[model samples]
Target: MIEKVKGILAGLAFRLIALLTLGQISPILSACVIIERDGKILLIDRSDGLGYTIPGGIVHYSETVEQCVLREAREETGYDVLLTGFVGVYSSLKRDPRFRAVALAYQGQIVGGTEHGSGEGSTCWQAPGDVFGHMAFDCESMLKDYLSEHQRFS
Candidate 1:
């Protein structure tokens, strides 16, 4: 089917990009946000076949990490989010299989915009517990850390 082919092509593309840039490139800096509402979390079913990821992407050179988080959230999830708190920075070498990457994660609340999907993936709200094992590229780790931080405070 077309969707299957698309997934294959996307996975191949992701692998190729990773192989082509690995080690040759410096640490990839990206930002993501955790948005929880109505006892559910916002998630993306990635088109790259890289499993589920939160609303985020690589930080543009033109923007700060916070700005990247906000921009990525709006672009990928169709929601303008307000970052309420900083979760933590995740810099594990194996965080992303494609390359060594660093991430700035934040806790966000939806402010405006209509919900929809983009080229990255489809956005959906699901229980945090239901999504634990399906996350991609260290996203589960990010979520766990965010939950731990929030629980400690709340």
Candidate 2:
């Protein structure tokens, strides 16, 4: 149909623009959370020159979101996590440094491993709103949405 063709073209055009501007199509699959316990959330400080951010990273090829979160948690926080569900998907050009990324933010709970910062930075626990003090980017907007849509958070 003509409408279908137009939709396909529109999607193609968007992809082409993103690839051209960001250098490459960085298919990043990341996740984060507004982990709250006793009215506090967990956060991290990424000294990778990218600044502090909530704990997460790229999802490996063939890995599911739950698997990615568990792996990333271990790599960054020295812990394994059990994913409850997705907070939401965040794919924005201005949020990250390079390519536009599709981050599958999930709600997870820590299960095991010692609390030691790994990879590119340090980790910490803070109030959900207070996280902005050390946040690397504007992911707080997404986090805020997750908080507001608690019913649909999963």
Candidate 3:
């Protein structure tokens, strides 16, 4: 038994040493979601440089999920949003073209800001069906989950 424990500890130490030598791994993180209200969804065009995507952005190192969501919404849409509930979490290795990102999705309601465009794309309210049809990523699953939650609660 002592020999087996020693072997396990040695194996763990070797793995730790190898991992430390491999250098730091960059973490890709983001917070976003399909903002829905009444029967429409919010969509935006990227202001940075790319195809149209849902309104959201990367999660800064020192920011909480709530803070990141609020900041991202305000930066991209020029409006402050009140997130009501969590929709889901998406962690696809290839979700972003440049890096892997784990996204925290939320169900939000707009409390302020006139409907306007900002960021890389124009901001507009689209029909729920149309929004799904034109989504930039695999957000339909998230949207579906949101709808399911609504039905379950309602």
- Scored against the true structure, residue 143 in model 2 reaches a CA lDDT of 63
Q: lDDT of each prediction vs. the true structure?
A: 0.81, 0.65, 0.67
lDDT of 2 by residue, 20-43 (tens): 878555455566655555766666
Best by lDDT: 1
Clashes of 1: 0
Name the better of 1 and 2 by lDDT: 1
Indicate the worst ten consecutive residues by lDDT in candidate 3: 1-10
User: What digit string (tens of lDDT, one per residue) describes model 1 on residues 1-154?
Assistant: 4544664665566667777877355677888999998988899988767678888888999899999999999999989999999877788777876556788888999999999998877899988799888888888877887777752221
> Deviation in angstroms for 128 in model 2?
2.1
Residue 10, model 1, lDDT? 51
Please rank every candidate by lDDT, starting with the best.
Answer: 1, 3, 2
Question: How many residue pairs clash per model?
Answer: 0, 1, 7
Stretches off by above 4 angstroms in model 3 are: 1-26, 47-52, 150-154
